[model samples]
Target chain A: MTMKRLINLKRTEARRIFITYSAVVIAYVIFQVMSSSGFLSSSMRGMLVPICAYMVMAVSLNLVVGISGELSLGHAGFMSIGAFSGVASAILMQSTITNAPVRLALAMIVGAIFAAIAGFLIGIPVLRLKGDYLAIVTLAFGEIIKSILNNFYFGVDAQGLHFSMLTDTTRLLKGGRLIIRGPMGISGIMKIATFPMGFILVMISLMVVFNLVNSRSGRAFMAIRDDRIAAESIGLDITKYKMMAFVTSAALAGAAGALFAMNYSTIVANKFDFNTSILILVFVVLGGQGNMLGSIIAAAALTVLPEKLRGFSDYRMLLYAIILIVTMLGTNNAEIREFFTKLNPFRRKEEA
Target chain B: MTKRIFTCALLILAMSSCAFGAPFKLGGTAPLTGGAAIYGTAARNGAAIAVEEINAKGGDIQFELRYEDDTHDAEKAVNAYNALKDWGMQLSLGSVTSKPCEATAAENFSDRIFALTPSASSAAVTEGKDNVFQMCFVDPNQGTASAQYIGEKGFAKKVAVIWKNDDVYSKGVYDTFIEAAPKYGLNIVSDTTFADGNDTDFSVQLTDAKDKGAELVFLPMYYQPASLILAQAQAMGYAPKWFGIDGMDGILTMEGFDKSLAEGVMLLTPFNADAKDELTVKFVAKYKEKHGEIPNQFAADGYDCVYAYYQALTQAKANADMSAEELCTKMIEQFTTMTFNGVTGENVKWSANGEVTKDPKGMVIKNGAYVGLD
Candidate 1:
């Protein structure tokens, strides 16, 4: 497809975009109003928040896996670090620091930074590995993180060994007993997550990813995806650009994680598993690798689909796999592309 | 290409409908088919049963249950959180233990949604959480509940607590047992921790438990480990009463457990569906009628919570005289009297900490079935 034809596809694409954006906004507003109206139960109303967060995670991870052509199963590690940093910071603000929106913003930034550091740490050694090797490395990274978090002592000893699962909300100083209770988890967190907060943060993350993917850094990464040796032959910094993609992907995952903590009140170790990392990658793949809007749409759809199909309990996963396979087969087939080409009358005229 | 577009569009439209006005949406994250799949799948079934039961009761409310596969990972659960939050689900469920719940709390489950984990028993989930409303008890609560039962019965003066360090849930329970043992005046002379869950040759651990002057050894693990550890403990001639936790609830009914290895063993939980209680008879029959089998406590609690959400909404119905805040107050007020007469017993009330505090009926391993303990 020529640039002109592709650019012209924007017209039809614009309509799709409008439909999607409208659907999301309308659905979000409708749910919020209904929930606030006391029409639904507190638990059902509560599910909306996570659905939005997952959409963002799905979209951001897509930027790396889909756009940059790298399989990163370790993104959850960065997210975990980000969650602790963000939540710990937010906890500090609620307890010791002066409470303000700036505190949350700063905490989110720090949390993203923490996640970025993690991404860099992992990316430094393993971005060189491709395909299954890369997947295995990333998967191992996730497992290692789980082990560490399972064993993490978020508190210190007598030298002010800050302890307790209630990081800082609820009862800050309780009966001289600081429950650094390592495995217990960080509890008593503040829930500052409103739809507006989650919406804005997600928007920013989406925007950042969108903008980055269109930049020179993006092209380099895309080139790396096409042919790393060829791109490197032209003196493209494969190591740097790959690491860049890895770091940015981690940063977004971390930001989402931090926002997650900000929305909820506690943290546990089991929440970030290898399967989750793979699921995010699934979004990137299912969304049409390298397509931004595709990822967003996929994320939103997957989030709500399983819930709607909750009635098909055991068959739920079967449906998910089916959907993934069908979509992949449907899109990647040459016959389908040929059919579309034949349908488009403007296509043959271009060669003429 | 055309088909992909059509399919995607159709999916988009369908998903929006599910998100907009579905009733009783229970958002839960579990390791549906992973290492924790045994428990996770059962928990998923528990959730599925709850959804089925609620809808079957004349389809009471207009709520939907949105389940996100957390794969038991905390970070990915953040996505589950976002998905649940975006969909505006009321109550969140699933995640059998601390990891996902911890990830959930970290991801902000407390503010966005009222979480009631049917299986998570980590002490961290309840210690300070106001929004984490777990349907099940925490480690300390479950541990103490069991300890009190064991101690009250004067089960033994000396106890050997065998646990695996690799698993946080096991460790948390053991830690609580250790702390509560001193209170109960039980001498925990021998506490052995294993490295792997698959290590069936617990000769060293069993030997240690035996040497520690154990009258009973508390082994809290899954079916495979529990069976392996039990056989090893028996072969070692330890003969200490093999006391464990709910892990053995259903295992008692499983055939793999040698009857010789299982006699006189005690396990503890609040409710077992096999019990002959009035609630148990009805709930189990109803649940089995729908799901085609006996429901575990997880399934029962999930059913109760989902229905409870409907009940709460009905009571919370924006009162004509009251504002939204007043309506919430009314709902919260009405929720207090809410007694879910599920296959388990009543779980209608929420504690000050937002956790369900009603005790489950007791169970003990007899042959392999988790028979009700009198």
Candidate 2:
């Protein structure tokens, strides 16, 4: 009976999950190949980490922006919270703590908590505001987080050691550490991240987001996105679902942020500026507003494009902007979408 | 999620701490793979070369070099630092950009993690932190050289300041040019600015300078700005003894600017690859063999920085399993008289402030290629 039920699962449901996951895995492999190739510029190779990190970011964001039908602009803020929490957790393990993995694990958890807290705080105020307002509130939250990071100070070191008078248990953050050295940033960290590590994290985050998005909750979220009034009329409990999506995405952003902070061995306040948030938006929007595979592709493509065009240097950005406009315009037209949709067998089956 | 990562980190840290004890683990954090990977890549390669040479020497202590890519972002620099610390690395080299440099200069990586940045020259790095050490010349030094050369040439009485305003590197150079050019008794009649790192053609700024009757203009910027400004200035026929900073080293070699129009442009470079010195000859040859091009300040800084880190490590591990703190202090002792015939020139002992107390050189763009004017 169980085997028969598994077999009887809707074709689209199984295909949606498999196709999305397979595409991500393949894209990352391609990215790895391109990064190792001799022709790929060194700058682009370095950008892969962010591409990896942002893939996680975009996917988690999709939980809110796409799957849940909510517009969030303050993802960078959650990332900031995750960074501080992760730094604090990592630093605590460094000084008083003995286990590296344990410290990192705890830091990741702490980062999620911080992100969840930040999400809740911002969600109540802005989630209620009608369309586009949520984005503005989230934008403000990102700025506020940056400002807080810039101004906050940790305790003075007794040993005058680089260790910010920060111990992981009591201290919310280690202000004086070399990695997230408060505003200027914490500098000079070791590389714990590789393609494998980044890919693993991205996969885990994607799986979690996918599970949440494909559930009954996910459909309700999508319903709201398509029409919030209709969803509420259908008794979808809009606020509860909105909060759920917001919190889930915040946690994922926090997770990615924590990993990113550890990846750099330094964290600076300015990096979480509005621009970083906007870049994530670009990834999600470029990929296809609600399309996970599209986001992953766009993220990987955009990350590597500038490197391929390094000879152009400053003009590379001009070319990228132009490409973005052209691609968006082309895809917005039904004829172009129809043309591409009919070309791929798998997608054609799904479309039919 | 945090619990899982913390568990793994603890497991790794425990293993690394036990495994890597006593050996000098030299690590670096730089933007090795990102938009600024060019800077970090050169730095990583240079560090690689130095680590190999030092390890090959086979001293009392063994050395392991671990490199972290910061992707030119400050947040990532912290992550790299944590990983190095977990690995029991006492001393580190790198952090190529001003943001990370400034972050460290604010007295972040001290005592436990000693740093000697190969590239960070922002004034902010040196302003506050005593632990942060820099090996390269500052933007002001480049600015001073240009201003002094222009003053010596008797180019013009009025000097103009035209540069990108929010760019820390260019602005640092511009401030130095304006302050020093006036100190040399030259009047700067016009000061013009542009937007972020994108502003190119300087026709408006050049015209303003020309209208202000400025005879010499100090354009301290990167290759993009240099290319646009030089071309536009030539078009406007506003040739006022074009002087520029060191950003013109590599990019100028293949730049499409009307070189014939820029016949008499003077540069106050610390050292040009085209110099006739034996060091320059050897460096340029090796650099071309390895990188297929001459070494710019970025490349030279990368090479010098790795060697400098090796020198410190070698001194620390001369006889004992000492900590990085002990090694860094001992480094200062050896630095008093240490001299390396760097790719640029004979760089002598470093000042306590990390500045290498040495004289620079003048390079003239004669026949379109940069050549040291003796």
Alpha-carbon runs more than 4 Å astray in model 1: A1-52, A55-68, A95-101, A128-131, A156-183, A194-238, A338-352, B1-138, B148-158, B164-172, B189-215, B221-225, B231-239, B254-261, B271-363, B370-374
Error of 1 at B278 (Å): 7.2
Report the C-alpha lDDT of model 1 over A6-32, residue by residue, as the tens digit.
Answer: 355445544443444555577667877
Candidate 2 Cα errors over 4 Å, as ranges: A1-64, A67-224, A228-275, A282-352, B1-26, B32-35, B44-68, B80-91, B104-111, B140-149, B200-203, B253-265, B307-322, B336-341, B345-347
Docking class of 1: incorrect
The sequence of per-residue lDDT tens digits that candidate 2 reaches over residues B101-174 is 66444423444356777777765565544456677676677677677777776777888878765355676677
* Candidate 2 lDDT over residue span A198-242, tens digit each: 687778877777667766787788888889889989899888888
For model 2, how many clashes? 51
Tell me the TM-score for chain B of model 2: 0.80
